[model samples]
Target: MNRKTLALSAVIGLLAPVLAGCGGSDGGSGGEAIVVGTTDQYIATDEAIAPLDPAAAYDTGSWNVLRQTIQTLMHVPRGGGKPIPDAASKCAFTDRANESYRCTLREGLKFAGGDPITADDVKYSFERVLKINDPSGVAGLLTNIDTMESDGAREIVFHLKTPDATFPYKLSTPPAGIVSKKDYEPTKLRKGFDVSGSGPYTFKAEVKGDTVTKATFTKNADYTGELNVQNNKVELQPFTDADEMGKALDSGDIDVMTRAMTPEQVESMVEKPKEGIQLTEMPGLEIRYLGFDTDAPTVKEKAVRQAMAYTIDRGDLVTKVYGSVAEPLYSLIPSSIATHTNSFFNKYGDRNLTKAADLLQTAGIATPVKLSLNYTTDHYGEATAKEFETLKDQLNSSKLFEVSIKGTEWKSFRPNQIKGDYSVYGMGWFPDFPDPDSYIAPFLDKDNFLNTPYNNAKLRGELIPQSRREADRSAATNTFSQIQDIVADDVPVLPLWQGKQYVASRDDIAGVEWAVNSSAELLLWELRRGPGAS
Candidate 1:
């Protein structure tokens, strides 16, 4: 679930407008309330449950709310360090094989409403995710767990079907956020936006129909966790348009704006910001690409898919669609990850019209091969329309492919794509964690997120498992490199551009750099009003 479930760095832009002095209505010190604006929205209906529910939500917006409202056994440290304890007093692997793990909770932990948090709550939280198995949920991240057993009220042990060194990192994510067994149903998603957990904050949302318009968070006095709460209160306001969000930040309606902004907006702010405004830029791991259902009739031919890859011009996309805000990605794994390689570049080099024609000609396929490309109209951003149009233009220029593009809203787009309704669809991946396994396993494994008919025996059955067994993750670089090579050969998915992260806030806002982790979960507790803030 990145905004796909998303990741996080900093360049600062100081704007020139004369703001109403530091002593305004909001207050004059660090205790003032904070309002954070975002373009990310949370949608729930009878068809889709409230994303704030830990068992059902998988996207970034939902995860952000869950992060502040619930606590996990472990959490990734700021600036990309190893996961440290959060709910638990301590956690460790008990077996040399890395198959058995255990945790001991802190004494006298309580939820926001004074409910005691026991080992059973932790067990219930995880088992419900597996039991509900929501189509759009993060259940895929917990597939490695085989069983769990509780030792008294504080200790919980987990047994895995196979070795998984990345399990600790997975636990730090949203899916493992401990929920109260008394409040959350075992098999059904909770009906509304109210959340009760032992996190640093207690949450309440104002909903209009199926949409959450305003989300409020107050420091949870009854909670126990590793995070040091900074602000006494935080409010989240969601907007459908980036420009509108930018305007809110400009008018001082919101204190901090993050999660997403159009590249053009970022470039404009970087060049000439309004007075009293500051913008920060950081390295992001969000990758957008084209996914092909290998069994779909239109894109079933391997040569056709390869020719489409050769026909795409990533540079053109960077220039026309994203400007200078994004980098052209050659591999599925972004450069921020360790084992990244330019396998696609090494093989295809550049967009070659001749090689594209040759590939199709050699396969005895007819020229102007007709294909339909599908993209989501709302999910990614406004640039997505232009991005896909650029893709269609590139493929049409090669004359080896005829492409018709269609756009759908995310509500129908995700489920339809999973059902294999589209031949080739545009999608994005935000890593579940900071490791290479988050990038590779979700796409290439037998039960991949794309729902494509792809299962490379060598890569999936051997290399992936072998890499997970290594306690030292850096030692598995070669294995990940091999996996990238295999993916480039298969061409089931075509790599597009990877984006950068941007957060715009008032100069008086503090902790913008530490508000988000490498894995992209928003840590609201890190935010506060700086000295001289209004």
Candidate 2:
């Protein structure tokens, strides 16, 4: 939502049909190969699309398939909750203690360029990420990887510094995908326009800086592994903008939509289904937030932060701005994952201007304590901006604070944030993994996820490392509860509503059930011009 390439949401430009309908397209009905339409274009790649380089991929929609079309030694299968294979067909804990793990590659598995997907390739891909050392450390979703060693042609071993129970889940991500050392020479920077990978589908047309497209994939008969789907072709058309995607979906441009749809778009699809259109709703990994620049003079006061939290009406924002599509978020950790808390609801259910004013007074915040809120205007569009305005009006009308709202494109939001340029800001997070650790890790720890440079003595010194020390993370619930308490009390980043996950598809587009990371993947292998398709 940080980039706005489409104006349909704001301008109300009906470039395509506006209606909602649904049914099923039988694979029984055949025509030319199905041509799905997309309203949004794939976000252009600065180079070729390659999951080989961690620095090269992270955006959700565009990255998911590229992450898939590329292979990893092990993958996290939906519902299985365990690691399966792509490069490594068979794997085991040779040590029996689950301390050291090894895997054997499937013979004949080769890159699109025909290079054997060797253990050395697997080692190179990982060591290279450590070498690049991406500052954001977002790549660390699979980090602390200690060392990856190759045992000749078919096998690879992983030695961890500690017993990581979530190791399999880590391998399930795109950042952990395997790559060819021959193709990804760690010594030189990669030009991704034409990269090598071994997945079900291979790249066809790549418009660098805009899109990388895969046409049809003939079955990789060699890939007789644990996965679903039989079709040989699929299209991964992605865009940085959500509205444009809505338009593209509305227009007959792409057959499937990989992101959450706006309420208006959802309404349209609800009205139609047989004309190659449909919608799928599920819980998502992404969570939007209201962050406070902890470095700011105003945000440092606990009462001010609490006042801000109490005064804003999330229900109104959901009804008016989100069209009640997204669920109201009362806690930072969403229920879709696990062990989420309804702390905010427990604290403040209805908006109370009087309570906020009293808290402000206790914190010495006199009337009209002028503050500015910043967000990415075009990213989430008019709806997001409207919500911010509603929040601003709520805070200002209390007579204890004055508020202003502003924005920038996501392309520039990062740098400004790093500089600590705003007092209050709007932010969002799509989990890097499916755990509570993912929810807590990125925000704090002095490294600065928000650039606010927050340091909570309790969190950094206590809860974090305690959770990391335990392999059975669910057992660390008591620690996370304390962490949540500190987070709520400190209020560096306040929890906002969680956006619902949605994917609008032409019934023919199959194989996308809820992904662990909450992505909608349309691999050609899982689809054919089937029932309820356009």
Predicted structure with the largest lDDT when compared to the true one: 1
User: Relative to the true structure, how large is the alpha-carbon lDDT of every model?
Assistant: 0.80, 0.61
RMSD of each predicted structure: 4.1, 7.2
lDDT of 2 by residue, 154-213 (tens): 888888755555566566566566666766667553554443477665655556544444
Please state the error at residue 176 of candidate 1 in Å: 0.8
Model 1: lDDT of residue 221: 95
User: What is the C-alpha lDDT profile of model 1 across 47-97, one tens digit per residue?
Assistant: 566667877777777888988988999987766656789999999999999
| Model 1 misplaced stretches (Cα beyond 4 Å) | 1-32, 532-534
- Which window of ten consecutive residues has the lowest lDDT sum in model 1? 2-11
Model 2: residue 343 alpha-carbon error in angstroms: 2.2
Model 2 ranges off by over 4 Å: 1-20, 23-52, 91-99, 185-195, 208-225, 238-251, 271-276, 378-382, 445-452, 468-473, 512-525, 531-534
